[model samples]
Target: MGRTVVVLGGGISGLAASYHLCRAPCPPKVVLVEGSERLGGWIRSVRGPDGAIFELGPRGIRPAGALGARTLLMGGDRSQTQHSFARPEPSAGASGHSVEDWRGCPRPLIPT
Candidate 1:
């Protein structure tokens, strides 16, 4: 048995946190909870029948280095799976931007 970690929400942060916890040398048991059936928080995507792609969420992630692979005992490595979203280039407009600017802020911050 190992330490148990309860993670609220199934958003990217929550999922990644749980993943890191499970990947630790002395991994803990992680339980992730999401209010709705869907996960990914602000990251979401869908493909049309004609093969057009539509993104309904925020953008991508860049691993500082090669991300560790996740595998299943019964199955195989999941790390090789193709990611649906890739980091997009910074756009001139925040509305057209796939992700927040590298400076850690979105463009055109509306004054509260």
Candidate 2:
């Protein structure tokens, strides 16, 4: 049997990793594990009864660059997410993370 790449979180990073891995020419098995029932980790949005939208956590898409953004935007099931990968959350422009932040973030899932 082929080796499986077990992704520990189902957040954007995890999902993105899975996406790229699946897209590879010799793609291996991928298993994503998220602690919470939802996939987006702390990135959440809640709609009020009066029809207001609120985002509670990391709220934007900061692509590494143009090509990276294009690669992510290019192919996918647009129907389900409604172009979510490219769309930043409400008030996203005000605050967000940089590529360096993402790179420096610790991988809580991988064992030492």
Candidate 3:
């Protein structure tokens, strides 16, 4: 039997770590634990009444990193939907608002 590694979170970082760990030369038993019922943590996408996609939290990923590229490919329509919005809510908010208001800034401050 292989060793087991229990991941504490289901966010991108934790999931990426677990993925790499499992893909190692000698794979281990990896189990990801997400406190919330949903995965992807702060990243969530919801469909609007008009059949458009709106991200409640962090949206898509940049296709730079290997994992990010993979995510973009796998996300498919959801990824495409990300670009459909003319302007995300967070960025459209009044300037100098709270940190929460800056979440979806036109382009995420971080590369992701």
Candidate 4:
């Protein structure tokens, strides 16, 4: 019978909260309750009908922001996102977040 912190949603904020909570000195039983099948709710990538990986709202991967940095501290597609972290979005970053064509290579699932 220990303390438990239930984090609602699997979005960036929720993920950050859960991650930190579990990393505390005496971490609690952090239970991340996400509705969807995947953890990353808003920060998601989907394939188009033509087999192109399209990114939705990419705020989570941008390293400029605090939360994004925290989430990225958990590790993201840094190769594709690092260069664009300081750069503003919607400014010809069409292939910036592409998982398949990351520097012309395959993106690893487990963060190294």
Candidate 5:
């Protein structure tokens, strides 16, 4: 008989855990127990006026231990997505600034 793995909750972490476990060399019988009727606790999507789909939840992620594909990072104008809360990044070559070019500190620290 194969091993039976019981996963609690249906959140992102729980879902990911069950998925990876099921894909292992010796796959196990995964039993996901979600308290709520629906899975994907916070991974819900909303349709915009133009039919564009958008998901809400965690803002950023770092693939330190896993290949993080969460958070929809929209560069450039945010109006298209109706996310006015996000400000656009500086245009490339507009400021003629480069990370390598350290133009000194802010107003206070600079010598007049």
Candidate 6:
């Protein structure tokens, strides 16, 4: 029988470790256990009504090291340009809305 490794949490760290372990010359059986229903942990993104994409957590990542750069390159979305966020706006701010006017109490204070 092969070896077995149980990984706790489904965050990037756990996922990367599991990926590397499975990709090794001699891989072991790995079982990942996540306490929460959702994976990716603190990395989150949301689309606003204005169509602007906002990230709630770690949005941009710098891949300098070999593995880090490889992971970034492999995972990168080629269709989307690197400066996609800098695209010109079709309209002014959120129509006639303001952050304060949001349905739910605004979590972070977005400066105008």
Candidates' C-alpha lDDT? 0.60, 0.64, 0.64, 0.64, 0.58, 0.65
Q: What is the clash count of model 5? A: 0
CA shift of 76, model 3, Å: 9.5
Clashing pairs in 6: none
The residue-by-residue lDDT of candidate 2 on 28-93, one tens digit each, is: 999999998898777786666664455678745455888667655744444433322224233334
Best by lDDT: 6
What global local distance difference test value does model 3 have?
0.64
TM-score of each: 0.56, 0.54, 0.51, 0.51, 0.53, 0.56
Regions more than 4 Å wrong, model 5: 65-112
lDDT for 16 in candidate 3 is 73
List of clashing residue pairs for candidate 3? none
Candidate 1 lDDT, 1-112, residue by residue in tens: 5689999989877887887788789988899999987988888877666655556775433334334233222123354343333232555354664344446433322112
Q: What's model 3's lDDT at 29?
A: 93
Off by over 4 Å in 3: 49-51, 59-112
35-107: candidate 6 lDDT, tens digit per residue: 9988878977676776666777763565688977778765553455433222123222435432223334334
* Clash totals for all candidate models: 0, 0, 0, 0, 0, 0
Against the correct fold, how does model 1 do in TM-score? 0.56
For residue 104, give model 5's deviation from the true position in Å: 30
Model 6 weakest 10-residue run by lDDT = 83-92
lDDT of 3 by residue, 1-112 (tens): 6799999999877877787787789988999999998887787866665565556786444468886677665445332332322345544234555444445556422111
